[model samples]
Target: MTEVTDFFRQGGGLSDTLPSFELRPGQIELVRAIEKSLSQHTHLVAEAGTGIGKTFSYLLPTLQHDKQVVISTATKHLQEQIFFKDLPLVEKALHKKVSACLLKGRGNYFCHYRYEMFLGSAFQLNKTQAKKVSRLQDWVQQTQSGDLSEIAAFVAEDYAFKKKITSTRENCLNSECPYFDDCFVQKVREKAKKSAVVVVNHSLLMADIVLKETGFAEILPETDVVVIDEAHHLPKIATQAFAEQVSSNQLLELGKDTLQVYRREAGDVEGFADCVEALIGAVDDLRDALADARPNGQVQLAKLKQFKRAYQAFQVLMQVFSEFLHALKALAERSSDLQKINERAEITAERIKSVFSPTAADDSHNDDTERQAAQSVAILEWHADYFKACRLPIHLGNRWQNVMQAYADSWLFVSATLSVGQSFDFFIDSLGLPADIATLQVNSPFNYAEQSVIHILPDLPAPNQHDFVPALVDAVLPILQKTKGRAFMLFTSYRNLYEAAELMQNSDFHLFIQGEHPKSQLIDAFMQSDNAVLLGTVSFWEGVDVAGEKLSCVIIDKIPFPSPGDPMIAEQSRYLESTGRSAFAHCYIPKAATLLKQGAGRLIRSNHDTGVLIFGDNRMLTKSYGRQLIEALPPARQVDSDALFTFIEDTL
Candidate 1:
């Protein structure tokens, strides 16, 4: 064992320093692998099961490394945990300190400039939203970092209130702003530049990649090593960052900003009011054209005739905007605000043109770099409440590697659910890592066979059947009764979640639904109440920790597969089929397996956590691929329904 592993042993530095330290062999092995990868300057994809204490495992090695390192996590919760909790523990264990800084996307930080402008702007607010704003007043003054996550009431459901207070890339004035000197984003990034280890979420990391590659000012410092904890989520985040998107919202926002700027600085510019009016009218026309369709999720742009006609009309309007923006360049010398407005207008016009073009995905950009970014095989999808045209990369592996390798020499991707059936092939192939990139799979230190029970309840309707939700709810009612409602009933879709929630409304348990409140508030309520049952969708599958008796059961309504109707998944399936690969094998099953593993993982969080994990779907017993997925998860003891009830009764 390496000295690092020895330090985690029973009488070692960590045990000597921290009273509650437990010797986890998996964590030690993970630490050794991370240390070796960092020292040798290589890449590693590791799957360390739950409760492995991976944050500390990677942090110990990263802290001791001579060169600067950046550690990115998938969630802000993990980002904050590593910076605020794990770093202190590791430093204490080693009896030495290393400087670390937490950096998040700019929107998370409070914007003094935006807040000032927001106060001056005459905005009509409802009592509810205004009450949320009032709640922020005290916390806003108390907070040092100004991260919005600290305020759970972000008005996420109310975009108008949020947009007024928060800063987005398009609206940011940067150094030109009056409050730029005391900017939270600036101060934190400057601190990160000097920090030995920088803590950031994947969104910020992806933003950094896009910024650096696009010849914009980059936020991250040059680092020798990069560790991505919760690496399973990175591929999706990267796909989004690398892809191109243009939306009605973008056009509308541009018009809004143009109108504001024109009134403030460019009133003398002729035809400005007409240009803004036309842009607004065109956006309204597009919205009205699709009013019947109300396109929500992923959709084929070509299939919608109205969408095409509206966009074609917008294309004509773009020419007018082009002329108007070009004219504004003559007035650009009037003020920096005018220059910025012109720049934003030009960029927005280009996005619309590129997205709306007949061969938008195929021959949109002339630059090789842009074309490389717009991968050869991609899905052109239209989505959302208003409208969005997006070109999503079908194969993101090679592109992800290129972006990541450009940033650092040694890279480590550590997550609890990176592997499927003891193999890292799914994850490695997804990220397009070379065959020789180091791979490791360490079992969680928790003895799942004793701590948990996995059950696929007998005789349930297939998820596709119309009666699935009711049947699933009926099957779980007894389990809920037996476990005393201290369970998380996770659903695949909001439809199913709502149906289940409706079915269980009359039950005695306190139900905490996902959308009824902020996610944090719902989880908090669930954890605090003994008879509470939290029903949630994708977000609850992972990143939830409830260690005590309050959460003694987890029930899943279906195999959490990527929806086939989802535009990205459909495109990926077609691309895989064309390449002579089974999309089910390459795309769907692996994605489902990782997600199922995450959901199942919510059950057995710590060594002391004993819970009943029930899968309401019978597919685990009948489907051909079910065994493979089952083997992929921790070795939870499979039990029949009667035995499961008995075990829960005995254990709890």
Candidate 2:
């Protein structure tokens, strides 16, 4: 194996390639450990702290391992960074050619057939949608990759336009389409099969695991090593993947597509249009029923009787869906397209039926644990104007472990926030990894004592108080003034963010609210302004890096605890109670600690960077769980508000 230590030494392998690269002992150690894990075919969990150059630490070793590897990250942005920026740099530094490919979800690619059909249709669209379609047409003719990210003018705000041009698994013609020879998704798969390193997001990786036996088995190539970055997010994402989800939007889309296919293939079919209309009507009735039952737009299925009309509406919707599938089957001989649509319709109907008519294994035939594993729970969630019924597994750990064991010979889970204090038990237990898995914690080389201060406002009231936002505004105004508006006031909820935004409306400082612009645009605007304050919520907490004087302070409104009312969290809490475990300590505290660490890590991006982190929740000092949160953070000096302001003033 190539020597990781030699690569980090002075005038080493990377020195001639990367002019400004500096040697970091922690990064070198992490690379060496990962290399060993890969060579030994053992599973490893590593926590590489901030400023450790973790991306390169893993990338370099994987490139030198001389085996196929799949690197899964938490987001598409990071996937692109590794494939385009980090991988190229590593290849240049090593003076070797390494085949690599970046693959995203199918929705990210443009379907040539769908684009053609969308253009040929006589559907009416508004001015903005029409303009977007026009732009997409011009780009489609010139682009080679056919990835949606290549279109500069296209934004996700136009969902209708996106749906019209992109193809889903249920709708894609695959080998039957006229443009199948030039299909972008198939081309991507072919490239991935030939590549040594494949960069993908967590969602794709999870999809590959869940759909391994299905037609989607080729989504991921065979690999010897699997490195999952941001591994803390794996358990939740995997749970969702293994769970069954049927949504009103899904039904509506199916109806719309069925109508489109009928029009194109067999427009004269009797009663077909009426069946589609009835299916759509049933979907709307159920959505309305759910809305009336829970005005807040979410309710657990166990407590669903409170919504008198939801059950009846769900039954009616399923009946109409079956009727539509029947009608499609009757027209199967009309065209191969109709036959394909009928097959997809039947699969969707079965999925909906399974969600509504849930069953558990018989107790006499199975053990208690097996019975519990077979149970399912339904959750109704609504966002915007769409509703979904998610049927989730009661237990996901054993299933996730089985999938992991089958997927790779060696596994490396790397993240900055994987451990709680000195223990990896919280993460390992959640993901069902073996107790004996290898572990490593590499602290950042930066000196936290000289670089950062954590400010605690112990006098503030609890976050639930009615005046908490007002008090928070009062507490943060002084810091913003001291720092001259180079701060990120990250709140746990949008209500707090909006209230703070209103408070700062007339201030001299330029305010950049989260929803006012895209995240990248907001960060750019913040960096360009001398005295700007960016107020945001959850997405701003992590994966955001602004190193110099552009961002000097981070103000968190509260320790981000999972909402007690969230259906998944409540379910997990119940499961823990049944197993005789402290859910608060086992589930809630560790989750919050990881998030708090991520938020605090936004400060001190480099050894030269200095900043103040403020917590206005008061729970960080008043609650007993505060100790765990404090222990999870970097070893920055804890100080009162006055001293914190003084330090910021002196440092700037």
Candidate 3:
């Protein structure tokens, strides 16, 4: 058997490469824990901190194991970094003959069939698409590496002809699409079948798990082990993946897709237009109702009743849509084509059923009796929170759970931040994993106590205060003055960001807001400007990486908790509150902690990366739970508010 060290040695033979990796005792212990767990087919969550070279620690052992290993990441950036950058480095270092495949959600690739359909339309012949098609065609011919981010620069239009289609599960047509054989999805899946390791994002991994459990084909059937990186995000990702909500956007898309199908089939173009108008109104009404009902305060059983009213109206719209589709199906001579459309609608209707069902079991039964049973369970579970917990059609935690029971030989979840305050319970419970699941935590290679500074602004106004924004700006200005910009002012709300940016009123710094430009453009502006302040919300917290002098300080306005008034949050809180649990702790606090950690995580990405983490929210010092939040974070030196500017000035 080839040794694990062989892959990391200087020139590339397992034995020849083994000599270079002078694995520190801690690193070796982590590898041993992971290897032991893999050998025993136990679940493990290992916290290999920054500078620990966590990626190599896990990759080396997995490569040596020579099993079909799937490394799942939380973000596409990390996924690409692993597949394109880190994996190659490891593979080259060890000189091992292991094939690695990178799989993204299907929407990343041009759906040839969908594109062809769009081509048949008059609107698609516009200058933008023409240029895009030309560029895409040229790139396709020259490109040996089939990654979509390469073409992301060219395809500037709506990624989701259906929804924001970057790479996702919603639009994946699987075997039903006419262009299945030459599909990029299939191509990657084929590669994954042959490769020893497959790198994918968490959503895709969950999608595969969902498909696998339902007896549908999945991407990792040939895989024996799994590694989930960015494990800190697992809980929230799981919760979100498991939760269900019917948004106006989803309903609108369905209506549009239905109209498109109608226009294509029945030459009754005017009727299709009418259907679209009706759908627009119905979706508008639904949105209006939701907007009127705030998510946070005034929580009563009445809110749920109101949501039901909206849901019922939406259901009626779906029924009317079904009737129209049925009429179209009946009038159509092309049974096969019409059947596909009707079946799609049927599946869409069943989405409600899937949301509430015992999703832990395969609900894709064909037999009359089994189908009936599944339907019954779904019906009974509809109003139950347990049913609502599955974040399917978007995420696949429930589905993955089912699939793992049947096929996965072992699963390894590794990250720099997996545990919360030295506990994996937060993640495990959220992922719906058993409490007894094996887990591990590895220390960081960097000396956090000596490096990063965690500054708590105890005197700042409460986050909800009107003066909070100005005070935050005032508090952060000193730090900014010290560094001369190069900071990320992350906020929980867009309104807060706008308010803070407006108040800062500093012309010396290039102020970039989240929605001002394309994220890439905004990031570029931030990177290029000598002293830039990027004000952003949730998305900026975790995935962003700005090393060196580009980012010197991170100012988090407050702990990022989900807005209480969100329809989903309201419903969740009500459900939890009814169950005799403190919705604040179970629903709100954990979420806030997770997000706070993510926001704080932006401060120290690498060992060389140094910055001041300033939490402008006074709750960190004033609240009792604040200590718990601090304990969950990396060991950073605390700085006095008055001394913060001096420290930054010294460092910069």
Best by lDDT: 2
**Clashes, model 2:** 0
Highest TM-score against the true fold, candidate: 2
Number of backbone clashes in candidate 1: 0
Candidate 3 lDDT: 0.66
Better of 1 and 2 by lDDT: 2
**Top-down TM-score ranking:** 2, 1, 3
* Candidate 1 TM-score, C-alpha based: 0.90
- Please write out the lDDT profile of model 1 over residues 505-548, one tens digit for every residue: 99999999999998888988888887889999999999888887
lDDT (Cα atoms) of all candidates against the true structure: 0.79, 0.83, 0.66
Q: What is the TM-score of each candidate against the true structure?
A: 0.90, 0.95, 0.82
Question: Model 3: per-residue lDDT, tens digit, 214-333?
Answer: 685777746788888887666555544444434445556556555666667765544556755676676566445444453322222122344665456545555565555555456445
Error of 2 at 107 (Å): 0.6
**Candidate 3 worst ten-residue window by lDDT:** 378-387
Candidate 1 runs further than 4 Å off: 123-159, 288-291, 306-333, 358-386
